[model samples]
Target: MCCTNNCINTENPSGNCVKGYGYGKLIDGENIKYINCLEGKCFDQYILVYAENSFKAPQNSLNYSLYYFEIKCKFEREKSSVWMNIGLRNLNTNKYIYYYANNAKIYNEKDEAFNVSINWKNNDYFGCGLVYPPSNMTNKSPYVFFTQNGKEIGEEILLKDNSESYKPFVWLKSLSVEANFGNNLEAKPFKYDISDHLILK
Candidate 1:
């Protein structure tokens, strides 16, 4: 789960003030009252928040064939035109691959869009994952995948230049979102059955 200590670094592109709360919750200060401001002239800005911990594929594993990390999240905003995104960022390269919930498209760091057929609404559950295959496999390239309500969406996107580790992130405009990072599986299990893809070691 994305707790307060784990999720940090809110990057506001438009220089507007933003706040992040517990349970991976983030809220834009656009519609809220800005206290201690000079005449309250600060404009609205989009922000990107990232997790402090980065996940890496397990190495020197004899039983596990594949390594993967996933997150299940729900949009807490009301029905609107505002955009929200969830994805993973490479810790070393700082590259990103994220899913745009409103447009149902996946975008990379270069802003290239890959179309998907599904659309999501308010309070709907959606997620993204990164999978890394074993070195013995023919294709050792790592790939990213998305899900909606525990079901896979579109095809897996291969990353030829895989980074050593990645951190989960959320991009918000004017709403809030909550995420489950699979920290305590017994308390809050993941929507996707991550166990199906690999052998528990």
Candidate 2:
């Protein structure tokens, strides 16, 4: 598990600012972040952030309320086909909202995956915030938005959920990407202030 504050990756990349998750292990030592990607080897690797309730604010933990991330992916060895995913994973209800660096998609409670319209790339700033549906008195889901160099690229998409705790997740296949989880994203905070949620730092 790498802490964003002290997860100094050896042989680090130049000017590579990576965000920290509560915990991340080199998936097969192949799939890695910018710091470890320099030395780690693997074509198909995955980094997962679990929806652990114990991971909360005031500590290096994960939260479901409000989360912001700045992620950049550099193609090290481009293959004939590149498959990658950066999204929120909720296993409890077997649902997921994913971005493929080019497009975005989501899976409903019944595990039905569908495509979403989005314009994205390797380097972009992503913000996920808690949204309580006006119609739902109790149901609330997180909405994800993408930006490039401070310019909004696409419309914010509301994720479909079914009472599942979603976690920041990554899946790489012949790709290399790194993320920043607000350990340093001070100037760029979530637009709406969140009071009840926890911060993942």
Candidate 3:
């Protein structure tokens, strides 16, 4: 037992630790968020958010009923091999369908990352996340797609389950991204709605 600020004593039960955001349980003071990402490369897992309401777009050209969320490239990866994924996951299964910048997947499944012709870098605002699309819009499949800037840059990906709700899921490798759920994105217009240009009112 020592009596100094630099020394650990009975009076100090909490040490120096930084609690981060994620799905992983709290340990010591660090957070283990990545469910299936490369360690030392992927990081920063936070709570997913979505807009759940029936509303109209800022303009009268679009009107829809559904829930969704989006993400933007806040930072680039340190390595060339590292990329980012913006996905939606089944709350129950925890499995997700995600997007990549320069890659694709043969099948749409959990933890699968697909490319969308997006060179996600600084100032690149990507809106590649959606929770639940109408059964018809989804083609009876649960899968979705990704978007770049203000327009979608990829094709329709498939999913196994469209029944369960989804949450925002991100996979970052040597990169960083920011998630937005229509809270304060006037500067970053949705660019394009994931619902295939919702029926105009």
lDDT by residue (tens digit), candidate 1, 1-201:
122333233442223223322122234421211122123443323556666576786675433343333433333334473557778888778888888887888887666889989876655666777766665664466677788777878777777765568887777654445556666679977677776656432
Each prediction's total of clashing residue pairs, residues at least 3 apart in sequence or on different chains, is 0, 4, 2
| lDDT of candidates 1 onward, in order | 0.60, 0.44, 0.45
- Model 3, residue 27: C-alpha shift (Å): 20
Clash-forming residue pairs, model 3: 103-115, 143-159
Model 3 Cα shift for residue 20 (angstroms): 14
Off by over 4 Å in 1: 1-44, 63-78, 199-201
Q: Which one is best on lDDT? A: 1
Candidates 1 and 3 compared: the better one by lDDT is 1
Q: So what's the TM-score on candidate 3? A: 0.53
- For model 3, how does the per-residue alpha-carbon lDDT over 1-201 read when each residue is reduced to its tens digit? 111342222243233213321222222321112232345534433323222332221222122344455655544334454455566655556665666554543225544444444455565766554333343443433345566767766676654533355655555543444555665457755666655634432
Would you estimate the TM-scores of all the predictions? 0.69, 0.49, 0.53
- For candidate 1, the per-residue lDDT at 52 reads 55
- Mark the regions of model 2 whose C-alpha exceeds 4 Å error after superposition: 1-31, 34-65, 102-129, 132-161, 187-201
The candidate that achieves the highest TM-score relative to the unseen native structure: 1
